[model samples]
Target: MSKDRPAPGDRIKPKKSALVQFTATTLQLEAFVVAFAAVALYGLRDSLYEKGPLELSDPNVIWVVGGVLVVALLVLSRLTAKPVGLAGGTVAQVLVIATGLALPMMYLVAAVFVAMWVAALRLGTRVDRERREYDAAHPETAPNV
Candidate 1:
């Protein structure tokens, strides 16, 4: 079969809700971070409390978990670099938050909460930056432009 292509003005468009998509993706990122923090905190709390303060030689579980999370976050950030991803990410963030709260922990709950906040803020900033860049590149398709 022969292939067809769009003319110069026939720019392909996205159909999904950029905001919703972004929000969902962001939620996923947040969830992953929260879960990671839970594990990390649970693993490190003893050291933090027993010793004077945190040290490099501590459990290091957080580093391991955080490293994995960083990869996932980076991938999501790249994939959902568009407005749609931001919307989806937000939704995902909510789900993550809810799940995080439901889980059990001795004192890890507090650390998880803090991590969630940091993840949300950081992810929001990244999404915002991506949206700006996307808007600049595709002025016509940019949301609320």
Candidate 2:
């Protein structure tokens, strides 16, 4: 085995990643926002844009797509605790912005959420690094997990 590899008898403890927790929380909140946006979209469909964006003349489409997004977001939030979950979060950002195609004003809303997502990723990573350093510096304070 290579020098960095641990022997078969060695066991490494696993700790929860702060980044994953932060990201998952962000996603859960975003799902809530999207759900409300869908309701507002249904109400304003006739008053704004004439429901012609992408030939979507039926308001029911709004409910269907919105419901799908809400469910997808919640599921993504649960998955975000896993290693591959970040990729789903990235794809979710794209999907959120794409909703702008159906409603022009949503572009602005999507931009705000996108900004939040970026912040979570960056800030969470920083917090995780700092947490690791703190634990390393003061092992006595570390949890006995």
- Candidate 1 residues lying further than 4 Å off, grouped into runs, are 1-14, 49-145
Model 2 spans > 4 angstroms off: 1-16, 48-52
Best by lDDT: 2
lDDT, candidate 2, equals: 0.79
What TM-score would each prediction reach against the true structure? 0.31, 0.80
Per-residue lDDT tens digits for candidate 2, residues 1-145, read 7766555555546467878888888888888878887877777766745542554546789789989999999999999867668889989989988877766677898898888889888988898898789878966455456
Instruction: Give lDDT tens digits, candidate 1, residues 1-145.
Output: 2235344555655445344354445445554556575565556555533422333244465455445545544455555656555454444444443333323342354445446545655665677678778878976555441
User: Alpha carbon lDDT of residue 67, candidate 1?
Assistant: 53
Measured on C-alpha atoms, candidate 1 has an lDDT of 0.50
Among all windows of 10 consecutive residues in model 1, the one with the lowest summed lDDT is: 48-57
lDDT values for all models: 0.50, 0.79
